[model samples]
Target: MSAIEVLAPGLLTTVQDLGREGFGPMGVSPSGAADPLALRMGNRLVGNAEGAATLEMTLLGGTFLFREGGIGALTGSDFGANLDGTAVPRWASFEVKPGQTLRLGPTRSGARCYLCVQGGIAVKSFLGSASTHLLSGLGGHEGRALRKGDVLKIGDAREAKEKGTDHNASSTEGAHKSNRLRSVAAKALELLAPRKVLRVTPGPQSDWFPKAAQRIFYSSTYRVSEEANRMGLRLAGPAIREGAHGEMISEGVSLGAIQVAAGGLPILLFVEQQTTGGYAKMANVISADFSSLGQLRPRDEIRFELVNFESARKLFIEQEKLLAAKDLIV
Candidate 1:
């Protein structure tokens, strides 16, 4: 069977899919790709299901040798990727031959990158997902980041071909050089800017903070703290004080929930966040821009902008349309 032999395991490289859903009730966090959009896009480019398991690389990417010829794609961040020492393009698919080594350098822009192979990575699934939940060590390849000498099996490429979704059938290298491809690539690259303004809506515990704290949160610029991880993003900025009620009963927390700790610092919850949090949340990032959080690096500046539910819903629909566009991949 076709497989990828890991020559070097990059910093925190793990297998992830759409995530483990319907298990939050069991106290399981919905661990998945930090940037689901990028995973989906890379899978689409390789003609695999949108949620196919992918190798999510954080900060730095490593080297791998393909044991069989196949098609692969990299998306999300530009990690100075090269195939057999020849530089390759991000957000595009390319052919990989057996014995060819793929290498990825330190990140140039974004914090995370997704590598997708045709037919996806064949790994044992837990709770119906191939995602790696590090905290619980529940899924993915032994439920942890990859290590050197690990051999990852590849799914049946012929299945994708029979389904008429083989990316090799249409040359991605040639088509990806077009103007339309350039536009999409530009948009993807824009998501990795040093400073970002994210849209948010009031959280369930928004009232716990005074109006002044809310104002400060919206107006002040916060820097992504080095303590940030897949579980939460710790922001260092203006202290947001609580009102009459300082503490609250622990309740369920959702992705993007901005919870304020005892020291008045806000922590933005992410994919691996706990199911419930005791701190009060002032706001929650809208679904439309949640994926952008995956690209934020340490010391990156962030500002919050309030948006209504309707506007947030519209933006999400627009993003969905963009992801559904087949021509965008080429």
Candidate 2:
């Protein structure tokens, strides 16, 4: 079996997939790739399933030694990666010969980067997922961030290939596959670009705030604070006045819920957020803008645009249509 040995683990590197769903009722949050779009694109580029487990690196990147030659792709933010001293481009596929070392530096564009290989990371799954739930420490490789000297098993490349096409496919089919890969890579570069304005819809408790507070929430600019993490992001901005409505029982909170704390600061719930909270939610980020959350870095400036629930649904549908289009990859 082929494997990759970690030489220098970055700030926080973990093995993650799309994450475990339908388990929130059991006190488990979906702790998958922070940037799901990037992971999907990287996996597609390497001819693996979109949800295949891959290495997720935050802020700083690390060095690794590949024990066997294989195909790989670096997606998400630009991390200034290099293979054997040669610069490797992001959002494209490349090959790593046996014994070659790939090194990556601090992120340049976003908060995280993903390294997807021909075969996804092979780790025992928990609750039907290979995602690392940092808070509970119950999934992924040993249920925690990776460290130096850790060796990760690579799934069988033949299986990944079978998931796409037969190894003995006709030359025409092979050519088509090659063209589709390039086209998808080109489209990913455009679709995944970061933006400063996040689209959101009124939260369940939107009516609790006064009209004046509502106006301030949409008009003001917020900066990602140092307290940001996968579980949530504490924004530093003009304090939003506390809602007049009295405290209520704790309820289920969805990802991207903008909850206002007593200090007037808003906390944006993320992929690994707690299932239930009592904070008054001012708004919920639309699904289309979830990827944007992954790109936000500490101290980064951001604003919000209010949209209706219907519009949010339309936006999500459109994005899914574009991503699933056969022409993009065929």
**Best by the TM-score measure:** 2
lDDT of 2 by residue, 178-280 (tens): 3243324366458757778999999999998998899889999999999888899999999887582435678999999999977888999998999999888
Residue 103 error, candidate 2, Å: 0.5
Off by over 4 Å in 2: 161-188, 244-246
Give all candidates' CA lDDT scores. 0.81, 0.83
> What is candidate 2's TM-score against the reference?
0.92
Q: Which stretches of candidate 1 lie over 4 Å from their true place?
A: 158-195, 244-246
- Looking at candidate 2, the ten consecutive residues that score lowest on lDDT are 165-174
Given candidate 1, what's the lDDT at residue 148? Answer: 99
**Candidate 2 at residue 101, lDDT?**
97
Superposition error at 330 for model 2 (Å): 8.0
Please write out the lDDT profile of model 1 over residues 140-235, one tens digit for every residue. Answer: 999889999999999875453233221123333233421122223555445433238999988888887788988889999999999888899999
Poorest stretch of ten by lDDT in candidate 1: 174-183
